[model samples]
Target: MDVSKPPFGDDDAHLRETTVSSQTVYQGHFLQLKRDEIALPDGGRAAREYVIHPGAVMIVAVLPDGRLVMERQYRYPVRQTMIEFPAGKLDAGEGGLACAQRELHEETGYRARRWARAGVMHPVIGYATEVIEIWFADELTLEQRHLDEGEFLDVFAASQDQLEAWMQAGQLTDAKTIVGMMWLQRWRAGHCQFDWQTVD
Candidate 1:
């Protein structure tokens, strides 16, 4: 490995693309499709199509006994039930942390006394501008869940070991959930650090 070069190399020299024009192909309740003409580094022009997302947040809620709060919900796009952390899209003008807090309560009926932002990940980088902020919640309190009218899910708890086993067995396949699990495992082992915050 050549340590002198940055891991992804210099963005300006090797990774920059200039957008020439953009067009919105479709706009839906939650997503907007866009097509753009861009000038590539090699002086070639190309068209790219992608989705414009409003961003979202995912929470890894930890109970006092070290179990994680999780959810099983049916995803329409994939036509399969998914195991995921409590998450929701950012409402119009909503902040990421606020969305995380609201999602945890609305989806799992649990509120945390302590919160920490783990990190962020772009689940669909190739064609979508969706960024999900990962958060960790602890010191939880049970509360009434207020799910959306047509929303349905089963909220449950699982130990870290159980989650690890599930992941190994290919049972947990949601991208954000897998990223959350990785972050939790690393943080627990002191390989990663989180800036914890008091509940607002």
Candidate 2:
């Protein structure tokens, strides 16, 4: 399948809303959205479900030597240590750019003089509409890093070749890390064709 092309066409029928459902389930971090079953073009009632989320932000930090600055931390939910870009869910009224700046500083002890939007992605569109906005942070300087309670992570810089080796060998599994690094790499190479496809 071509990644550049979206499978479904953008048509009125594609977004056709037939039945409405009032049922809702809230779970703090996410909400379950349910719509009443409706008849499809084939004369069948299709069940539709979607998870609502507040979205998220992440940052890809780059040093002068084309090295990637990333984090290694133990994720509580996954119960494993993983590598990822500095990231977090947006606080109430917090903008994506601001969240990226704050998270990068807090997690990596690095501050960027310039920042750019990397890309926004849908991790799991089949269930959750959890879109994540990524940013690129450059012209960095090390600052006082303030870690939250129970938050433990290591920050380091590595060549993309090294990261790719680690990834191919099953070392790095975090989605944000992979996405940020890929986008940043493309951006630096001047090969990105769209603004939403890469930062700056």
Over the stretch 1-200, how does candidate 2's per-residue lDDT look in tens digits? 89887887586674565653434644554445654455565455676676777889988778988787878888888899987778877777888987887888888889888777867998888778788998877788899898888788998888889888888999998877788778867886887843332223
lDDT (Cα, 0-100) at 67 in candidate 2? 88
What clash count goes with each model? 0, 0
Top-TM-score structure, candidate number: 1
lDDT of 1 by residue, 1-200 (tens): 99757897555766688999999999999999999999999999999999999999999999999999999999999999988889999999998888989999998899998999988999999999999999999999999999999999999999999888999999999999999999999999998878888975
What TM-score would candidate 2 get against the native?
0.80
Query: Clashing pairs in model 2?
Result: none
Residue 124 lDDT (model 1)? 94
